[model samples]
Target: MNAIEKLQSERQRVVARLAEIDRILGQYEELQRIAESYLASGASHTADSGTVTDSVKTQAEAQREPSVTEPNLPRVKSPKTPMVEFERVVIELLSEAEVPLDRSALYKALLDREIVIGSPDESSDLNTLSARMSRMKDKVVNVSGHGYWPKDRAFLPGGYVPTGVDDMPSQDATSESGLV
Candidate 1:
């Protein structure tokens, strides 16, 4: 083919690829907008058309706590112990307990003492508690099957026997690293 014709064909291909890239970029931008809207409103959204579903709360509504007369309102955040206070409470609870408490039992105790605030949705509270506890390696040890134990005490809670059945890697391992 002639040199000019070949150059034109290459230019056309480049233009077509650029157009395709622009179309893909537009799709990503739309998806990002949809995600931001969903997060801001705490509302469910359909990706295909970016339509709202009826399940979740609006941003304004979520921020405002509903009255008792309005029982069907979306869940709201409850008053919670500040993180520093929460750490103290956990230490106190684990130290005083006669038996090691599993995650669920620990959650119940926190709710009972009002050390950790309760919410309308209990499962979310449990999840939050679990996440917080997972970070507390220096303060507590989650001995498998036995439950949480204060790290400083260096003793298992009463009524828990070492059966050699699901021990941590080693006592020395835990003590040396300051994490069990």
Candidate 2:
């Protein structure tokens, strides 16, 4: 067989492996969510009796105090922390890099940093990252020939303007105007 045929065959195998890995990762994430939910709900039972006890109820009752409450007042829950802060991480990485990094390179960098990515409902995927970068036109600029670079380095001494930054006015103007 020709070299092109061999390469195509190899590509097919690699794609299959990637799909399998993705499936396994999905299962792993499901199991992780289940375990976390169980732990968060404080699952406990007697060894011999195998009966569940209400630990939260016991604790709340012990700490309960009498307080005047208005009949019309509504109860509010505290805000939840973010599940993943990937946008900040990417912005920091892109800003710190000396050269522009493509999507694959950025993904590898994130993985090396122990940031779990590519799972469903996660922003670390390339599509999501690209959408975010596109929205953050001021912070990142896409070079014509090169990849994405920090906006500060958009000028290349060739009198060429980056794509999206052209429409966005000066950051100073935006801040002063407070329209951004």
Candidate 3:
């Protein structure tokens, strides 16, 4: 190939690589936003180390097997407590990273910065946070085998123009028939 042809090929390759990098970066940013939203929702609850009080358990049992005249059931108090402060710290870390970070990476980053949320005593806390985000996948982003990415990108949005694919129905062709 001539020098001009060679340079043109190199430029095209560089542009393709840059586009791929941008897509990856975009996925990371979306994940970060999801993590922040989870923390901000105040869903982080701590488990109590102590066993349930005997009186409370007894009362619960009595309510379960009610007499013919009594229909009221005893309300059970949750053993968990909200860790609002810790949640805020985790959210802050996620916001600062502005990228999709695995659980281990996030924990390490927080530790390096001396963030108290993922302290040794609360080693499994980060897992809980991840679980919370995972549960909300449908409403936010689809987090399957590849972690999280915006759903619309995987599936074209309404009136989208698809390119670089095999034979498929054109957007205008479908809409013109009023069949959608």
What TM-score do all the candidates reach, one by one?
A: 0.43, 0.37, 0.26
Cα lDDT tens digits for candidate 1, 21-118: 45445455444545654565567744544222332344444335322222232222233555666778899999887557898899888867655444
In candidate 2, clashing pairs total 0
Best by TM-score: 1
Residue 98, model 2: Cα distance from true site in angstroms: 1.6
Query: Which 10-residue window in model 3 sums to the lowest lDDT?
Result: 70-79
| lDDT of candidate model 2 versus the reference | 0.50
Rank candidates, lDDT, best first: 1, 2, 3
Runs off by more than 4 Å, candidate 2: 1-84, 116-124, 154-180
Instruction: Please give the lDDT score for candidate 3.
Output: 0.43
Query: Model 3, 51-154: lDDT tens per residue?
Result: 23223233334334323232233322222222444444555655444233566676666556434443234557576656654654442342332333322222
RMSD of 3: 27.0
Between the candidate structures 1 and 3, which one is better when assessed by TM-score? Answer: 1
